[model samples]
Target: MPITDEIKKTLTDPTPLYALAGAGDLAYEKLREVPGKVEALAADRQGAQEMATAKLHEAQGLLAGAPAKVTEAVTALPTDLKVLQERAQGFALQQVARAVELAVRAKETYDELAERGKVVVDKARPQADSTQADAAQAVEPSDAAEPVAEPADPAEPIEAELLDEPPAPKKSKPRKSAPGVTE
Candidate 1:
C-alpha cells in the first residue's frame, strides 16, 4: 500500500479516536483532583512554617541556658550515653521477641492447616479408590456376560424388599359414576 493510503486508513479507523477520547476523559479526571492537591500542599506548607518557628524558639531558649549547663552536661555525658545504649538494646530485644512470637504463630498455623489437609485427603481417598476400582472393572473383559450396573442416583430412594412379602401395588383412581346415576 502507498504511504498516503496507510495514513488515510489509520485516520479513518474509529479505535484511535475512541482511545483519544478515553485519554481525554482520564486527563479531565486528573485535572479535577488538582485543586484539592493544591489546598493540601498549602496546608502542609503552613504547618511546616509553624513547626519551624516553634523549633527556632526552642533553640533560642536552649542557647540562653547553654553556658550555665555546659559543665553539668559535660559531667553527665558518659551516663547519658550508657542510658541511650541500654534503651537501644531494649528496643532490639523487643524486636527479637516479636519475631519469635510471629514464628511461633506461623508454626501453629502450619500445623493446623496440615492436620485439616490430612483429614480432607483421608476422607477423599476412599471415594477416589472406589471410583478407580469401578473404572478398572469396566475396562476388564469377563468370560461370562454380566449386566453392567447403572450409576445410582442419590436423589432417588432405594426400594428395599420386605421380608417374605412383595411391595404393595400402586393404588388406581376410582371410576367416576355416570352423571344421572347414583352410586
Candidate 2:
C-alpha cells in the first residue's frame, strides 16, 4: 500500500481521529492560557528588578558613608580606651581598698581569737598538770599490784604461719597465640 493512502486511512479511523481532535483542543487551550501566564511572570520579574535596584542603592549609600563613619570611630578610639582604662583603674583601686579593709578586719578578729585561746590555755594549764600527776599516781598502784608479763616475740607466730600455710598463687603471664596478636 502507498504510505500516503495508509496515513489517510489511519487518520480517518474513528478512535485515532477522536484522540487527535482531543489533543489538538488541549494544545489550543494551552496556547490560550500562555499570554496570561507570561504577563504574570513579566510583572513578577519587574517587581524583583525594582527591589534589587532599591537594595543596590541602599548598599551604595552605606558604602559611601562608611569611610567617614570609620574615620570618626577610629579617631575616638584612643580617648574611649583611655576613659575605659580610667574607669577600670578606679574600680581596681576600690577593690584593693575594700580587700585591704577586709584583711585588716580579719587580722583583728584572728588576733582577738588567738588572745582568747591563750587565756583559755593559761586558765587550764594547772588543771591539766594536776590531772597528769593523778594519772601517774594511779598507774603506780597497778605497777606494784601486778607482775608484768614478758613481751611476746612479735615475729614468731608470723614465722610459724609462714612455715605452715600453703604458698600464694602465682600470677601467670599472658601468652600470644599468634605472632600478630595484640593486647
Candidate 3:
C-alpha cells in the first residue's frame, strides 16, 4: 500500500502516532501560507527599492545640470557688465568734451571784450585832455561843464553777462540687456 494509505489506517486507532500525524498536517497547511506572504512582501520591497532608485536618478540629473546652469549664469554677468561699462565711458567722455567747449567759448568771449575796452580807452584819452584845456580857457566854469563820469568798466559789464547757452542735456545710458532676457 501507499504511505498515505498506511498513515490513514494508523490514524484510525487514535494513538500517539495518529495525533502526531494530524499535528504534522496542520503544520504543513500553515507552512503553505508562508510562500504567499513571502512573495507579497518581496514584491513590496522590490517596489520600494525601485522607487528609491528612480528618485536618486532624478536628483542626479538635477545635480548634473547644475554646473551648466551655473556656467550660463556666470558667463552672462560679465557680458552685461561690459556693455554697461562701455556705455558709461561713452557718456562720461561726451560730458567732459561738452564742458571743455563751454569753458573755451567763455574765455574767448572775455578776451574779445577786453580788446574792445582797450580800443575805447585809447580813443577817449585824447578827447579828455582837449576838454580840460578848453575848460581852463573859459572865463567861468559852470556846473554843466563838470567832467562826465567815466564809462563803467567793460570788464565788470562782461563779468555780469548772463550765460549765453543753456547747459548740455545729460545723456542717458542704454539698457544692457533686452527686456525679456534673464539676468
Candidate 4:
C-alpha cells in the first residue's frame, strides 16, 4: 500500500481506539484502589519516619569517623616513593574493579526489573484485551460507511519481538591489583 493509504487505514482503524479505551478502563480500575492504598501508607508513615531517623543516625556515626580514618591512612603512608606508587596504583585498580562490579550489578538490576515489569504487563494483558473486545462490540456505526475490518485476535499481543527477553550483559574479568595490595 501507498504510505498515505497505510496512514489513513491506521488512523481509521478502531483497534487502537479500543486499545486506548481498554487502557483507560484499566487505569480507572487501578485508581479505584488508590484511596485504600494511600490510607494504609499513611498509617505506616510513623514507622517509616522512625526507620529513616535510625538510618540517619547510623550515617552520621559513620561520617563522624570518616575524617579520623582518612587521617590515619595518610599518617600510615610509607616514606619510600616506590612503595607509595605501588599503593596508589593498587588503589586505582581497586576503584576500577569496584566500578566494573557496580556496572554489572546495575545491568543485572535493570534486567531483573524489566523482567518483572514484563510479567506484570503480561498478567494485565488479558484484562485489557477483554476490555478492548467489549469496547469494540459496544461501538456501532451511526451511518452507512465502509465496513470496518474485524478486530484481530485479542489473544495475540501487539509485538512479539518486543516481548522477547534481552540478551544478558557480558561478564568482565576482575582487575589484578599491584603486589602487596589488598582488594
- If scored against the real structure, what TM-score would every candidate get? 0.35, 0.31, 0.29, 0.39
Best of the candidates, lDDT:
4
lDDT tens digits, residue span 1-183, model 3: 699898898776434443344455556778999999999988799788999999999999999899999999988776677898998999999999999999999777555545554555557769999898898868578888788544387556443234565768999997699888978
Pairwise lDDT winner, candidates 2 and 4:
4
Report clashes for each candidate as comma-separated counts. 0, 0, 0, 0
Residue pairs with colliding backbones in model 4 are none
Order of quality (lDDT): 4, 1, 2, 3
Model 3 residue runs over 4 Å out of place are 1-81, 139-183
Per residue, candidate 4 scores C-alpha lDDT tens digits across 1-183 of: 699999999898655444455455567778999999999999999999999999999999999999999999999978899998998999999999999999999777555555555555677889999999888866964456646544388776556455586978999999999999998
All models: lDDT?
A: 0.77, 0.76, 0.74, 0.79
Question: What shift in Å separates residue 141 of candidate 4 from its native position after superposition?
Answer: 7.2
Give the candidates in order of TM-score, highest first: 4, 1, 2, 3
Q: Lowest summed-lDDT stretch of 10 residues in model 2?
A: 15-24
**Clashing residue pairs in candidate 3 (N, C-alpha, C atoms within 3 angstroms):** none
Please provide, for model 1 over 1-183, each residue's C-alpha lDDT reduced to its tens digit, 9 standing for 90 to 100. Answer: 699999998888655444444455556778999999999989799788999999999999999999879988877676677888998999999999999999999777555555555555567779999999999988996658867444389665544323347768999999999999998
**Superior by TM-score: candidate 2 or candidate 3:** 2
* Candidate 2 backbone collisions, by pair: none
Q: Each candidate: RMSD to true structure?
A: 27.9, 44.8, 57.1, 30.8
